[model samples]
Target: MKETVPLSVTESSEAEALFHFETGAPEAVRAALGLNATRIGDVVAVSMRNDPTRYWSKALGFGRTAAVTGELIAEVCAFYRAEGTPLAVLQLVASVLPEDWAEIRAREGITAGSSWVKLVAEVDEVVARAGAPDRRPMDGLRVAPVEPGDAGRWASVMMRAFGMPEEHYSGMAAATVTQPDWYPQAAWLGEELVGSATVYRFGETAQLFGAAVLPEARNRGGQTGLLVARARTAGELGCRLLVSETGAETDGGHNSSLHNMLRLGFRVAYERQNWVWQPAG
Candidate 1:
């Protein structure tokens, strides 16, 4: 087994920004979702005006290229305001917060929010902990990279699994499969699709962007299967590490997703508190 290597925060942030920016080139779903991924210097500010949930609007990976000045924060807020986003989660690693963030945040209507636990697993660690890279059918489920014709079905399962019935979300999810840099995976219970997951490749790292299982498939190991499928692909492609994040276990609120990732060998790289902005009328 090859020894694990280092994964710098800079590379991980850059890769995440690229993944967020990926939606811009896919015009088909871009118009359908009213999605925009804007970059103010190194910061990536993304928004989806068509989704009522408003969870899609956030600015992340800021302050790497330069200090996050008050003006830069204002620019991000203005972008969200113009996009009609109800809220924006402004996220960055805690290590990079400027000394004057409190002043800037107070002036911009920003409020503190819960944190997300970023996780990382070396390829060798995954191989050892999750078993050898294998995507063959296990139990009653089979996992594989999404096929072109199956993108719509993948989107359907993804949106439904996430409890989102909005048609545009399916459109947004499906459009990601068409991107050359993204690797979307799906698990099938015989002929029926039960789960979906996606990984984005940027250089030596693979970002596990999203994954979910149908309610009916819960407790059936579908989540583990998705992890296995992604690990197998990342292994074959020489990816040094797999990166992902889930809502932190907070205030007695247990997160099953975090448990799944830890059980599969991913370790917490850091806990980053999210800053939320709600523009005042």
Candidate 2:
């Protein structure tokens, strides 16, 4: 592991911006279609206009101290409730202060969720690691960007890989392919789809997410291939920074993706806390 340093102010701000751009992209698409997405400070609150997934209907805070005022949090939560969101999630960048956490805990119907570490790497470095001269592509595995017709298969593989419901991932895949600059890629082995990944570009930064691999393909190099393919594509698009997040290092061996990312030169830049609100009986 590389030596770690505390997050500087500029690094914190940039990471927060990437977080908002990445988490807010889908909601931003929904908002462009007249859904309820409003900005308060560096926070963006998106409601369940179409998809009712908690991931789709929540408030996203960017930067250090993204949500400083209790009033901002209350208003955003109220907006989601008014829009019929059963559960509201507040995902804040590592810069959030203790007072903000205290105010959030005081809110009715809210509970703390998982904390995640945001990882970042220079696109050049990832590209180099991915394109090492001795690194040969895994035999019997092929990866490529999804065509428009691959949406159904892509959705099926994603749902199965993540154990998500068909209804949820199907609709998500349908809507996602139509978003601007959303690149969904899939990996296959002898015509069987085994894994999937996605990259969303914001300015010079490319945020990677939604990487899923089937259980049968776990021991193989499918996951690493998918990561390298996505990173290369992002670099080809002129992005300089590659940002991603994974569950923090808590359970000893549960965060293999974090290990994979570190091997690809990604460093833990900061952490984010998740606060969730579900209506009481």
Clashing residue pairs in candidate 1 (N, C-alpha, C atoms within 3 angstroms): none
lDDT of 1 by residue, 68-169 (tens): 688888899999899887787888778778889889888899999988888888867776767644533356777888998998999899888888864767
Best by TM-score: 1
Residue range 72-169, candidate 2, lDDT tens digits? 66776777767766776777655554465675667656778988887888878988988787765676788899887887788778777877666544
Q: What is the C-alpha RMSD of each candidate to the true structure, in Å?
A: 3.3, 4.5
lDDT, model 2, position 112: 80
TM-score of 1: 0.89
Q: Where is model 1 poorest over a 10-residue stretch in terms of lDDT?
A: 2-11
Off by over 4 Å in 1: 1-28, 132-139
Question: Best lDDT goes to which candidate?
Answer: 1
